[model samples]
Target: MEYMRTVGRWRRVVRRVAAVAAVLVPLAVVSVVTAGPAQATGCRTNAHVYLTSVYPSSYRFENQPVDGGTDDYQMFAGDSTSFQVGGNGLRPYTSPAWRVESNVSGSFVFNGRVAGGNCVANETTVGLARHTVAGEVWTVRANYLTGNSGQFIQNQAHFRIFFVDPPPPEPWYWQPCYYAEACF
Candidate 1:
């Protein structure tokens, strides 16, 4: 009779332990599986400058970096190319003007007025690049000269700038599981 009682107590203890483990083991696994990739703590935005031509003509375009370096790229008419404006660290709500030069000559017309002369003609025309934060990206646009004659030249080179923001940080509970194995 005593042996039977002892066996019954042992079974109850085993059942309790199994029930606790059933709950905890799955919880640990779910914590691990549901935990996603680490996210950036803060928002770091970057400016990307894109250049496209409206007219179907090829012209030489140059991009001057913020750190005082120059890169030349040839853009075909109705095509686009992109580059980052600010080097590694980009400032928010800042407009960084880029030095864009083209071999084509003429006066640039922007918004119904002659904005500036061509880089080939004046050699000092700097595109007044401006940027605005639109959601996760910063948008920038500039107009430059294109074509041969100054008589029929309009703003041919169109620059579009975008500010790319970093992805949002992970949830509060997921941080511990992602960074440390203590949650498991």
Candidate 2:
């Protein structure tokens, strides 16, 4: 009888924890969504870098950390930072999404999605680059990541059967399990 009572108590504790988590998780999401744009106002709340295009809206790209563990990485808006590459996420680049007053017509600004902007770059052109958590930044114009090819490992559930790239050809596309978007 005492064992059953203890089990009941444990179940109640689990239920209470689950209920609290359910409530708090949504609130955390709402707070993040609400904070993104508000923190980013007036051309830029605080830009980590400025991407210059022949037109800012004309040329936009997505990038991720090569190591995905703790090495170099790229920055995008509305993305969550994670230690692993799979844990990172990205949203499509939108024109005039976050702006700051600039004389350069094709210039736009970008920052981290969740918290205060980290790195700020001025007079920098939008080229292929990788940055680090240690506040180091660099750009790369060659050897960019192409999801159009290889169609790398991705997880999409088609009625739970699960679909992935063929084993042999194994292209490098990463557009699954990520809100129908790309994740590095």
Candidate 3:
């Protein structure tokens, strides 16, 4: 009976050790594998675009951080800031929806959509060039698309572009496990 009890106790100890190893070994391996090359991407930084209006509906300037993050845009009217538009694809020459003019400084055009419209206003000769502000600004002109000014009316609309930072690179790692006296 004494010998039997000793054997049972030893078996239980071995089983308990095995259970602990089963859970802990995988965790250790994962930690080692994932411990390398952890970087903060745009998602981590909340990077985005910023804008300020010198005068309401008169003139405005926009700024975007060089880093890749939120891509948020903050628009100001008087003393209040509202959401104008924001995203991650409004770089100088990188974004497809925008075109940069050489002659005009900071000049840009919205080849894409504005407020979900095709941006086909009456004066279709709209070309956006960056303004002289420290950030990004555009000088916009409205010309009649049909060449008739009397019949067509001209309207001024204010819009801003917001761009976020690019995403960070992903990391890779390996995992290993150990079981009591056995390596698995």
Candidate 4:
């Protein structure tokens, strides 16, 4: 009968609309969920270390001064349990072009190499016992070692970077550089 055909057509149309809605509603919901603001991590806390000087041994540089010349470095403290350090240095003929290193003293241990111009960091992390170093400030005597010997340029170079605990993250906000010791 004509009435039965009309009912069948309406049911088909309703089923199509329901199927489309099922797909679209979840897609919209996923977009909104992902778009929400990122939660702040404890790693953002103020943590910094300054070189104040460069000490390259025979394997590093022959005779380079750690003064007036350019020194490159970066330091980041993650929570109170881990930290990261990376940077490059160019000391002319006396020293090699660049060197990089990092250390983590917390539950998550991490180490990386200085490759592709010091921009890319590969996470080869492993789990360890987490240990906390109290406070939000610390320093280290970072050294560059080449071969089995340390090297230095003709003159010493003084380099330093100030650390800050933060609600903001940017290079410009670091502390001013101050003289420490000569890199002989």
Q: If ranked by TM-score, best first, what sequence of candidates would result? A: 1, 2, 4, 3
| TM-score-superior candidate, 1 or 2 | 1
Question: What does candidate 2's lDDT look like per residue over 69-169, in tens digits?
Answer: 21122333121212110111121121112322222223333332222122112232222232223222322111111222211221111010111222355
TM-scores, all models, native as reference: 0.26, 0.25, 0.23, 0.23
Error of 4 at 38 (Å): 6.3
Candidates by lDDT, descending order: 4, 1, 3, 2
> Cα-based RMSD of the predictions, in order?
29.6, 25.5, 30.4, 21.8
Q: Model-by-model lDDT, in order?
A: 0.33, 0.30, 0.32, 0.34
lDDT of model 2, residue 157: 11
What is candidate 1's lDDT per residue for 1-184, written digit by digit as tens?
A: 9999999999999999999999999999887765632221111322122322322322223233323322223322322233322211112222323333332321222221222221122112233333323232212223332222112212223342232444567766634456645665
lDDT of 4 by residue, 1-184 (tens): 9999999999999999999999999999988876653321112212111222224311112234344444443333333332233323321112122222123231112233332222222222222233323232222222332221223332223232233344455555545556894533
- Which candidate would rank higher by lDDT, 1 or 3? 1
The segments of candidate 4 whose C-alpha lies over 4 angstroms from its true place after superposition are 38-184
Clashes of each: 2, 14, 21, 30
- For residues 25-70, write the lDDT of model 3, one tens digit per residue: 9999988776652421112222122222223322211222212132
* Model 3 alpha-carbon drift over 4 Å, by segment: 39-184
lDDT of 1 at 97: 38
